[model samples]
Target: MNEPAAPAAPETLEVPVAALRPSLEAVLMVADQPLDSVSLASVVGHPVETVVAALQLLAEEYDEQDRGFELRHVAGGWRYYTREAYAAVVEQLVLEGQQARLTQAALETLAVVAYQQPVSRARVSAVRGVNVDGVMRTLLTRGLVQEAGQDAETGANLYRTTRYFLERIGVSSLDELPELAPYLPEMDDLEDELERVGGLPRTPDAVQDHPAVEPMTDSQETP
Candidate 1:
């Protein structure tokens, strides 16, 4: 007697190109990163040109509808982002929502990272006058801050604010960040804290003397 026939592989669903908008929306809604047309085409099992056109149509529809969310092709891929006009309302909702409330420490740490980035943890702690490891972890979990790389001399991990942070704060670029002089800790305070903290370089000149990866400017940064 022969063994039972092996189970057949599950059939892949072919999303019809003509009807791909909703399917694309559903996947893009759940995606953690921007998706390019080629990747989306593979997912929908359609031709690249067809998927590209479908994505463009969906984007245009969202624009025409003036929806709270819009599909955008950014950083060479497609993703759903909150419409800029409604950012303030979304921010309020997220902030008021129990799970999204960022503590004062986290906020301070985030600000330091935002302004001083590709900055190291020691530098951040120095600026905040407290150990920032925990706060950094929280920011990382929230997708607000990411490790850029290591410091050249000290080899400490360098962190930078993410585009998500800019979106949450409703800024197109760091230049759009509100007058940093008022909201962020004073330079004197950072210097004093750096003195007390006594680990990372004590001044900008020192930090600049040696560097690892180049810091990304808002223009160069991907969302």
Candidate 2:
């Protein structure tokens, strides 16, 4: 009887290839943060090519659907973020009262720090044509800027933007900052002033100092 045809060689189960793309999209949609390709592949137990292909498909699908959110590569990984068209709506909901509106002075100070990071407080003040001691303190308190290190020449504290700055600006990194060519004259002037001072000086105690330094607040008390 040919031993029942060798038991007909037990059948092996097959996984559906079409399900890969949807599975990857689901994972990305649910993740709270960006996911690296390698990490995603490891978690999904799939080849890198398969994962990449799936991600591209998902991104295209969102684009075609005109969804309010999309998958983007950011911070060296992929993340789902609200589309720019719906930024205002999302901002209204998630950032209500949480985001402080930036003052003109604060914006200027932030621009200086962003471009000339690892710069000294004295430098930032010189660039803004105003004392930034208070503004810098406000930024520090808000977690927008931090002491990157000490300036080797003058032992002054070197400051730089934090990850929060990137998040607030919706950029992956400082490299995304707009080209300054159109506004170079003004920026250059600020840089020159900072260089002249060798560094920004600590404000004298006589300056009207406010104890509660809040960043991006329109109603900050003048020190």
Candidate 3:
């Protein structure tokens, strides 16, 4: 048999020293999602350490210069975001009916998922007293919610918030979510509201034995 072909030579790059930052900037300007340092280093033909240092310097320079936008490392990657101090200015322009904001229903559904995930749509419906199938689809399409796995007993698909959700909400982790359980309605109130707002009338069995959402629990931690 013919000997295995010699491995192809590693690709060579000769990016000019002065062009490193500009070249990185150009690539990032068109990126729709965050790009990690390894990807950036590969593209710029630089060592990973060098690329990371350059990115950090660029981030600092932007902060020192008080730029309109600042580089951020979010969700395991780097991207540019409008500085928080100027959010009102950017929001004024971006929210002028040009971009669609999440509906109130969507927002409510999202909150339920963020707190109660990995939860099933049936449980969310029970909690909200309305069908959540449509709302779940919208969240999935928006990359805010994703299917986690099947519920062990019911076999229903469970859902959880994505890293993109954390990024959008400006939190580093799920544990950073605010403590709102104390303010939520009691379980009795929820059961009453569910019935009043068009949820299934619970039999005595469901009221006692159903594995529905508990009064927003403080002990539930992200997996």
Model 2, span 157-185: residue lDDT tens = 78999999999999999999998778766
* lDDT winner: 3
Q: Residue 152: error of model 3 in Å? A: 0.9
Clashing pairs in 3: none
> What pairs collide in candidate 1?
none
- Against the hidden reference, what TM-scores do the models get? 0.45, 0.43, 0.46
Per-residue lDDT for 16 in model 2? 35
Screening candidate 2 with a backbone cut-off below 3 angstroms (N, C-alpha, C), the clashing residue pairs are 122-200, 208-223
lDDT of 1 by residue, 143-216 (tens): 89898988777888789998888888888998887776676467666555555554445577754453322222
**lDDT per residue as tens, model 3, 78-173:** 898889999999778655623467888888999999998998887777677666666777787677899998888777788999998999999999
Ranking of models by TM-score: 3, 1, 2
Q: How do the candidates rank by lDDT, highest first?
A: 3, 1, 2
Q: Can you tell me which runs of candidate 1 are displaced by over 4 Å? A: 1-98, 182-190, 199-223
Give candidate 3 regions above 4 Å deviation: 1-99, 194-223
For candidate 2, the clash count comes to 2
